[model samples]
Target: MTPPTLMSMMIAGGLIGLGLALLVIWFTPAQPDLNDAVKRLSNTSPHRPDAEASTVNGKERLGIWAMRTLPVGLWAKTPTRELALLRIPLARFYGDKLTYAALGFVIPIGLATFLSLLGLGLPFAMPVIACIALAVVMFFLPNYNAIDDAKKARIEFNRALGAYIDLVALERTNGSGVRQAMETAAGIGDSWVFNRLAEELNRSRWSGLPPWDALHALATELGLPDLDDFADIMRLSGEEGTATYATLRARSAAMRTAMLNDELTEANAIGERMSIPGSLLGVIFMAILLTPSLLRMIPG
Candidate 1:
């Protein structure tokens, strides 16, 4: 075939492929009903239980569609434990992964087309390889992001719990019983972590379960070990009628110390990372300074 005919055919093929992609996207199936999943997980709709639910937007909706339509389950296992810790739904997590993976797959196609139009043709296999590699990275990007978010959340929860412990100790010193102290302390803070604790305490009260038991269950579900320890202390106080004020005060102090230690450790690690680029810059400067001297010493 003549070059003109071949180029025209390629352009036509590209346009047709683009049109088919757009058509598929436009006809993508609606997201499956997540009500049952929500109810089973939290006994509440996605919106009512937390503030995070209120922030759902278009991208999340797209993710929901992807999650429903794509067979992601065959290869990618849902990070259920991490998602629970982050207070993210499994559906949302899967949806996010799908959205990112779709972007990964689409971006290379657009790039290749742009390059080809600019007279910079890549090998036939290059775009295919790039798409697969990018898609895999993007697919797991959400999981890494979720892990980091969960870590920060756990840190915030521990900080808040430390304050909560002190508040509980103060309430105990004011002559409240264990349950009363926990509920009162939880009620005193307006933070979301406090809100969660208060909700669990209220649930326990309504269900006639011990406050500590509720806390233990919440801790287990959310993977908060410090909260579990706090629950253990409360359990001891309730079961043995032991003097808990001193113990709570001690635990609160220990938690504050531990939190401080964690902050220092993280800060030091960050500083170490920041120094690396500066060190590299210094080495590069030294190399530049020495290059002329070394060249002069070399024989012509």
Candidate 2:
């Protein structure tokens, strides 16, 4: 074929490919987000405004689009409980992961281009390997971050819950009902945990669901056994009209003790790890000091 005809064919093919890509993007329906569906079903749970379909940001939409396009097995499993505790939307988390993955994909190409410009030809496999490895790492980076953040958040939530239990007990001793004590205790603290509690309580009240049910759901979603126990305690009080001052106080004390023990154990492990480097340094110093003497003692 003549060069001009070949060029014309290539151009037409490129245009056709571009057109097909645009058609797919514009016509494909976005996948329904499971997290949003669950939240919609649960009337009393606090819902983030950004989790709504209409309010999704560009990055979040990118994430949802990728989720829809990719095979289910190819994507990392969604970290629902961690996301719930952190109040991070599933769409936003996916967005962050995909954004990192895109960066991972682009970086190797950029580096290869720069090396090519410098007259350094990398093997074909190098960039491909770097791209896959980095992309996989970057894709899962958000999972690690979410899990770590959730671990810390759980600690904070448990600590705050202990304090809250104390406050509730105080309110109950002052002749307040279960609902009134919980609401009053939730409103007392200024931390995010307290704010979350207050929001859920208010939402439950508005939705006409019992406050204990909301608390229990929140606890189950976030995997908070302490909160679940607190919910059960409140449920008992709410239903049986029983005084719960002693039970609340006992739970609070046990929680505080467990927290203290965990802290101490963690500190001991950290101390053990810290000692290794110092011991190694000391051994190196002794070896350095003894080297000349040992050499002199050897028959020369």
What C-alpha lDDT values do all the predictions have?
0.78, 0.82
Model 2 C-alpha lDDT per residue in residues 1-300, reported as the tens digit of each score = 753344345435644674575456545555667776786767655554323445666666666776677787866588889987887767678778877886786688667766765767577678779978998999999999999999999999999999999999999999987889999999999998998898889889989989999998888888999999999999999999877999999999999999999999999999999999999999999999999999999998
Clashes of each: 0, 0
Model 1 pairs whose backbones collide: none
Candidate 2 has a TM-score of 0.83
What pairs collide in candidate 2?
Answer: none
Residue range 1-300, candidate 1, lDDT tens digits: 754345446645865885676456556654546664466465222122355664545555655656666676643666665687667766567667766877787688778777777878777677779878998999899988988888889889999999999999899889999999999999999998899888888878876888898888888777888999999999998999888888888888898998889889999999999999999999999999999999999999
Model 1: how far residue 185 lies from native, Å: 0.6
**Model 1 spans > 4 angstroms off:** 1-48, 51-75
Scored against the true structure, residue 91 in model 2 reaches a CA lDDT of: 64
Candidate with best TM-score: 2
Candidate 2's C-alpha runs over 4 A off are 1-42, 46-54, 296-300
RMSD of each: 3.9, 5.4
